[model samples]
Target chain A: MILHHLYILGITVEAITGALKAGTKKMDVFGVIIIACATAIGGGNIRDVLLGNHPISWVGHPEYIVITTCAALITILLSPFMKYFHRVFLVLDALGLVTFTIIGVRMTLALGHGFIVASIMGVITGVSGGVIRDVLCRDIPLVFQKEVYAGVSIVSAWLFLILHAQGLPEISVILITLGTGFSLRLLAIYYNLEVPKFNYTQMD
Target chain B: MILHHLYILGITVEAITGALKAGTKKMDVFGVIIIACATAIGGGNIRDVLLGNHPISWVGHPEYIVITTCAALITILLSPFMKYFHRVFLVLDALGLVTFTIIGVRMTLALGHGFIVASIMGVITGVSGGVIRDVLCRDIPLVFQKEVYAGVSIVSAWLFLILHAQGLPEISVILITLGTGFSLRLLAIYYNLEVPKFNYTQMD
Candidate 1:
């Protein structure tokens, strides 16, 4: 029940981000809905499909779609007030990110995948929707460039694994992972953390 | 046997295009290989995953990845000459698009989908790879903005559905769809066809 509500919170925040991106692109309602859904669930869809987990999450729970769609619609109405909520969105997005990674790890593990695979799937589940959203909006992905995004997913995923192996209760694992992961992400943001990057310019 | 070889040809061309795009972005060899494979086989991957088709094509036939990676390397070496082969690339891309659509339709219908679903998968198979490539490279999708790219997929998919329903020989169906779709795409390039698009502002 807590996990379900957390999933809903994550999807709702992600959908609003998607709608904001679509609004920036000045897209129509159809584009808004599509981008919103992509941001909210595309990661999970990709992860599940890649792992051959049947009936995908949204397919199994139609209510997720309804929640995301409604979230998008609400975002459309709330765009004028967006600037004031930029910091709020960032914090929510961080919370959602950690929540998504933990959920991903749980799902992949339940499907009998090993810890390494679960960690990878967790990252995919956390970051992929935003990648899809940015791509659709014709922007470079923030997860690739912004402060310590994808790396956070990998770290949190592994953290979940180690803790789970120690025989922690599921709720404790979820809460500790969520708290530590969210704080880690916020610190990364506050400090402007960056992954090492390479530039190849032989052609240029 | 013949269809398998044609599939190989299609991926080769798409991989080159992906390499060229990554070159423009000045990404490293690793990036080039990743983008090339995404462009070459990403559409089929997306289509299959969406339809719950198991053992994804590249996973089932690992050689496809090898081919695309080699294709990307070759493209890197040939980048200086890419300007001269603009028309050649366009022609090959068209062939790949149609071939991909046909393959997608066959796969989906084989899984017991109706024509409508098959047609949708066909377009997705035909165009999604390039979309992925452009998005990863941070460019507006050519399919959405350039002349009649995605439309060609829809039209060819529908054409294949009609001809296929008439009990045409498999080779004949493939050839005719290939010929007509390629020609139609080239003509659209030559004449510049466009779909209507709109920018939305206030709700009113």
Candidate 2:
């Protein structure tokens, strides 16, 4: 029940983030809605497709689409107010990252995938919406270079797998994994932590 | 039989294009392979996901992954030689566009989707891989701005639907779509044609 609420909040926050980015690009309303929906659910969709999960969650549940669309429209209207809420935005984004990773891991495990695959799936699910949003807006995927992003997902997912494997109850697993991942992400953001950049120099 | 070979060639060409981009980014072998495979088949994967088509083509036919990997490897080795073959590259790329569009249209039709959806699917299948490749390489997706790219796919797909609606043989439909798309793409490239640019101005 908590995870469901967190997931809903995460999708709403992510949709607003997408709309803000679209705003910078001066996209029309349709573009804003599309990017918003993609940013909200692109990760889950990618995870589902990777695991051959059918019907795609949102396609089967249209309400999620409505929620993200409304989020986008509301975000566009409140664009000026967003700049004052950087801390709130960061906190919500961290929560989203952990929640998405947990959901992705759970889905893959339910489908009988191995730990390694599930971990990767978790990372994909956590980061792919941002990737899609950035790519659609013609920006570099933040997961590939941003501060402790995909790293956080991979680590959290692995932690979940290990904890679950050690006979932890499902509720404890979710709560612990969520706490660990969320705290880690917030710390990374506070410290401005980053993975090492892979800038390649031309040899010839 | 002929279409199969054309499909192979088209994939190989697209893979090489992806590799060429990866080379510019000075990526390692793993990055090259990922981009190559993504460039070769990401479109179809996107279409399949959008349509709820399960298993994915590459998951079902793994040889595609191998082909793209090999193409990337070979491309890296032949980087210098590729420069001398600009015309050849254009021809092959044009071929790839048409082939991908036809395959997308054909797949959607097989799934019993309407002509409009099929046309969109065809456009997605024809252009998505390149979009992915561009995004991964931190370049603007050419399909979003390039001359007649997605338009050619949509047009060809619509043409196929019309021909099929008129009771033309499947083979004839394929040939006509392929020919029409290829020529249109070639002409667009030669003339440096472009869709109207949608440069947005920030209001606030």
Candidate 3:
């Protein structure tokens, strides 16, 4: 029950960031809304598609569409003051990522998938939205290039599976995974930790 | 019947182009194969996902994956001589686009969707692979910037719907749409025709 509300809050935050990205590109209002919705829902969309899950969640819940659209409009209105809220947004974004990762793992496991698929789904849910947004906005995906963003999701997903296998209560698993994943992401951000990049120059 | 073979040919051509793009970026062989697969199947993937269709075609037919991988390897081997085949590739690509668009429309209509959805799906099927390829390559999608690419798909889709509604034989509908669409795309390339680009400068 609480998780559902958190999911809503997570998507709303993601939508605002997506709208801000569209602002940077000077996209029209329609494009802003489209990008915002994509950023908020694209990760789950990709996951469900890969899993062959039908009737995508948003299709069944148009309220989510309304919510993301509202978030985008509000974001555009507050664009000038957005920089002042940068620190807050980062914290919220970190929380959202962890929340999304947990939800993804739980859902995948519920669908009878195992650890490897679960971990991939969790990371995809955590980062693919931002990747999609960046792609649509014509920027290199930040997750692929830098940070421990996907790494955090992978760890959290594995941790969740391990703890669940130990017969922990569902709530306990969620709380432990959330705390660890959130802290890891924040630390990575604060310390500017980055994964080593694969820069493959041609041998020609 | 013949459509199936055309579909296979279409994806093979798409995969080769994707591999070529990956080569220019100096990606590893694995990256080249992944991009090639995405370029060949990404359009249908997106269309099916959006339509909430399950068991994506490729999942059911691993042969498609094998075909694309083989195409990518062949492309890499032939990369040195590719410039000489540029004209051949362009014509093949045009055929692929029309083939994919027609298949997309027929699939959507078979699923009981109306014209609007069918047209959108057709366009997505025709151009989305290249869009995904360009996005992964960190380039603005050429279809969006400077081509009649998507426009051609849209026209082909609508034409298919209209001709099919006229109670023509299924093969006749397919042939007519294919002829007009293939010719239009070739003319677009030959004349360097382009859609008007959207350039939205922000108002301070």
* Residue B196 displacement (Å), model 2: 22
Single out the weakest 10-residue window by summed lDDT for candidate 1 chain B: B195-204
lDDT of 2 by residue, B70-102 (tens): 998888777767777768877898888888888
After superposition, the stretches of candidate 3 with alpha carbons farther than 4 Å from their true spots are A195-204, B1-45, B52-130, B133-138, B142-204
Q: Alpha-carbon error at B22 in model 3, in Å?
A: 12
lDDT of 1 by residue, A145-204 (tens): 878899889889999999999999988998899989999999988898888876777975
Q: Which window of 10 residues has the lowest lDDT sum in candidate 2 chain B?
A: B25-34
What TM-scores do the predictions have? 0.60, 0.61, 0.61
- Report clash pairs, candidate 1: none
Chain A TM-score, cand. 2? 0.97
Predicted complexes: DockQ each: 0.15, 0.12, 0.12
> For every candidate, what is the interface RMSD in angstroms?
5.1, 5.4, 5.5
Which candidate number has the best DockQ? 1
TM-score of chain A considered alone, across all candidate predictions: 0.95, 0.97, 0.97
Candidate 3 per-residue lDDT over residues A1-204, each given as its tens digit: 867988999999999888887777756565566678889999998998888776666755667877998998888777767777888888888889989999999999999999899989999999999999988889878777666888888889899999999999999999999999999989999999987777888998
Over the true interface residues, superposed, what is the Cα RMSD of model 1?
5.1
| Candidate 3 local lDDT, B104-198, one digit each (tens) | 99998898776766776787799889988988998766665445776778789999999999999999999999999999989989999765332
